[model samples]
Target: MTSIDRKAAADVIDFLHRHFPRGWKDWGRDRSVSCTMARKLLIALGHATRAERGAEPLDPPSSPGSLPRMDDTLLALLLVAERDYGFGQGAHRWIRRMKIRNDPLHRDLAASPDVFAFFMELGAVEDGAWTEPAIPALLRYHAALDPLPDFDAVPGLHAFRTNAINEIPEDVAAEMSDILEEERPSLWQLGMMDLLARRWRYPEGWLAASATGPHLLRIPQDALASWMAVELIRTSRAA
Candidate 1:
C-alpha cells in the first residue's frame, strides 16, 4: 500500500478544519455535496489523480434519490476524518478502532434511517458488489445497534465473520478454549459456541450445545480444540 504523505494530508485536513469548524452538519443534508467538496479538496492537494478527478459524478443531480456510491461514501468519510481529527497514522488508527467499537460515526450512520437503508441495499448483492470492502465496518456498525439487524441477510456476511473469527487474539482464543473445555461450561460460553456454530456453519456433531437448564447448557469438551481448529482453518481458507 502506498504510504500517505502525512504533512500534505495534514495541510489538506487543516484547510477543512477552518471551513467546517462544526463538523458534518456544516455540509448539510445532501452527502453528495460533501463528496463533491472532498473531491475538489483532493484535486487541489494533488492527492487525486487526473483519472480519479475525472470520474463520473457518483451522485448526479438527476439521481438525487439514489444512495451515494461506495467510492463517494469512502471519499466523504476520508474527508470527514480529516476534517474532524486531522490526518496521519493516528487518524487511520482512530477510524479502524471506531469500526471495531461501532462507536461515533458508525453508530450515527446506522441510526439514520435513510443511510441504514442505503447500506442494507448495498449489502444485498452477492457479486459485482460495491459494498464488499465495507462489510466488516458495516457489520460492526450494525452490532452496536440496540436491535441488531439480521446479520445472516447482510451481503458478505461470511467474509466478515471469517475475518472477525480469524482475527481473534491468541490470548482471547486460549481463554475461550479453556472455558469451553470445562465440565459444565457457563451459559455465556455455551451461547458463544452456539453463535459460532450457527453463524459459521460448524459441523453439528463436532460441537453441539444443548440447553439443559434455565441458564445452563450441555457443552462438548472432548473434541472442543479439534472442532475449533477445524472451523478456524475452514473459515481462514474460505475468507
Candidate 2:
C-alpha cells in the first residue's frame, strides 16, 4: 500500500476506534473477526495487501487501497452506519427508507455535496437511470446543513412547518408519490393539540359567543387524526 492507502487505512482504524470504543471483543467480535473484516474490506475494495490476506494484525500501515477510484468510501462509512442502514435488497440493508447519520459520513458528504448526491443516487442504482430519489424536502434539509450545491437553481422550495401537523399521506398510488414518508416535514406532533383539547379552559362565555356568531375554524388532519377528534369552537366574521 502507498502513503495514501496508509493514511486512509489509519483513518479507517480511527473510525473503528470510534465505532468500538469499548473494544471489538466487547462488541461481540468472534475469534475470527480480524480476518473476516480484513478479507471483506479487501474484497469490497477489490485490492489487498499480502498481510491482509494473512493472519497478521491490521495496523495503520495497511489499507484496502484506492477508495476514491472504487467509490469505496461509501463502504468505509457504511462500516459504521451498517448497524442501522445500508443499500441493496438484502434484509440486512435498509438505508433507502431511512435517514443518514450526523456522523463522519454525513460530514464528508456535507463537505462535498456532489459526493452526497452520488451516494444518494446509489439508492436507486438498479434502475441505471441518472435520476436520483432526492426530492425538494430532502434537498432543503441539505440546504439548511449548508450542503445543497445548486441552491438557487433548486427553486419552488416550500418551507417546512413543523407546527403544521398532518397525516402520513397513505395515497402511495397518486400524485404524492414523489414525497417520502420521513421527508414529509409538514407532519410533526407539537404535543399541544390533544393537551389543549383536554385542558385549556376556554375564556368564559367564548362557547356562547361561538354559538351565536358565525365562527369557522379549520384544523388539518394530523397523525392522530381519526376524525373522532373533538372540534373546538369555531368563529367567523362577515367580510
Candidate 3:
C-alpha cells in the first residue's frame, strides 16, 4: 500500500479503537468484542465512504424510521476500505470470514486484529501528519479483536444505551413499553419514562405520577442503580 492508503486505514482503525470497549473481547464469552467488531466495522466503513466522497465523516446515520442499513453499511465499508485504503485481497478475505461468522439476529461477529491493523494503516495515510509506517505488510500480520454481542438480546438484560433514540416513533415506543411491562416491568417502565421525559420535557411532577401504587420494584431499582454505577465508573475512568 502507498503512504496515503496506510494513513487512511490507520485513522479508521484508531476511530474504531476509540469506540471499541476496553477488554471488549474478554467480556462474557467474548461476545462483547465480537459484536463491537462487526458494528464498528460498519461505522468505520461509513466514515471511509464519507471521506472518499469528500463529505463529512458520518458518526452515525440518522433515520426517522427503523434502524439504518447495517448490511449496506458493511458493504460500503469493505468496498471503500479496499478501494481507497488499499486493504488488499488478503484483508478482503479476512473480512469475508468475519461477515460469514456474523449471526446478525443471533450473535455478534466483530472485526479481527488483522482487520483493525489494516484500517489503522489506512488511517495513518488519511492523516498525513505522521511519516512512519508502523506495520510494513498485511501478508504476515493479523489483528486479534474480541466479541461484543447485542446485550439487549441477552436473556436477563433489557436496559441499554443505543443509537436508536431521538428518532423512535411513538407507536413503536409504546409497543416497547408493553413488551417491557410483560417481561421486564421495571426496566420497561424506566425506559419509557426516560423517553417520555426527554420528549415532553415534563416537570418533576411526572416522576411522582406512577400509577402502580406508589412502591418501587426491587429489580427495577437495582437496575437503575446499576446503570448509574456503570456510568459513574466509566466517567471516573475517562477522567
Candidate 4:
C-alpha cells in the first residue's frame, strides 16, 4: 500500500460509515464488520493506484507493505464496488445490491463504492481474460465506473462471457454467473431468501420472508423466482 492507496482506503471507510444503514442497524465495532473491512482493502488498493501515478493521496497512508490481504468477503466487496463505480449512471443500482450486507460476518462495517470497484478490476487479467469465472459483465460493470484503464480494450471479452455461462450472451452470462456465485450460493441459501424479500419489496424481517405460508410446506418457488427476477432486473439494467 502507498500513501494514496491508504488515503483512498480511508476515504472508502468513511464512505461506508456514512452510507451504512441506520434504520436497519446491525453490527458491533465498525472495524469488526465484514463489509467495512472489505471496503477498507479496496480503498487501500485505489490509494495505491493513485500513489503509483504520483497523484496527491486521499487521506490515510497506504504504504506498499501495509496492503491488506484479500479474502472472499473482500473479493465480494470488490465485485460490488466495481459494479457501482464502473457503471455510468448505474452506480446507485449496483451499489444497492450490496445493501444486503454480510450478516454472517456481522462485524459492523459494510462495503462501499471504492472497495467494490477495485475488486472487479483485480478479478480480470491484462489480456481481458477474467481470472474468475466470468468476464463480460464484470468488465462492463468495471468499465461502467470509469473508463480509466479501458477494460473494453481487453481481447475476447465477449467470448469469455459466452463460454462461462452456457448459451446466454457472454456479458449477460458473466454477470449472472458472478452474482449466482456470490449472492445465491447454497451456503447462503437462507440469506439469499432474505435478500429476495428485500428485492421483492417485502417488509423487513428475515423469517417472514423464508417461512412457509398457508397451505405451503416450504417457501414457494414462485416467491423465490420473484426475488431472482428482481435481482435480474437490477443486473440487466446495470449491465
The per-residue C-alpha lDDT of model 3 at residue 226 equals 35
For model 1, the stretches where C-alpha displacement exceeds 4 angstroms are 1-135, 142-146, 159-169, 175-239
Q: Candidate 4, residues 69-104: lDDT per residue as tens digits?
A: 222223333333432243122225435422322222
Most accurate candidate by lDDT: 1
Candidate 1 weakest lDDT stretch, 10 residues: 211-220
Candidate 4 accuracy as TM-score: 0.23
Ranking by lDDT: 1, 4, 3, 2
* RMSD of each candidate relative to the true structure: 18.8, 21.5, 18.0, 18.0
Candidate 4, residue 188: Cα displacement in angstroms equals: 18
User: Which sections of candidate 2 miss by over 4 Å?
Assistant: 1-8, 22-39, 42-56, 59-70, 84-239
Model 1 agreement with the true structure over 1-239: per-residue lDDT tens digits: 01124453444445454455543345323244343455444433333322423423222113121233232233343334333333212224333321122222233331122222333343422232325445322332221114544445545544645566756655445555564555663444454555443322221112223311111111122122223444554544355
Clash tally, candidates in order: 0, 4, 42, 28
Which of candidates 2 and 4 is the stronger one according to TM-score?
A: 2
Model 2 accuracy (lDDT, Cα)? 0.28
What are the lDDT scores of the predictions, listed in order? 0.36, 0.28, 0.32, 0.33
Hey, what RMSD does candidate 1 come out at?
A: 18.8
Clash pairs for candidate 2: 215-234, 215-235, 215-236, 216-235
TM-score of 1: 0.25
Model 3 segments beyond 4 Å from truth? 1-32, 35-117, 121-125, 128-167, 186-239
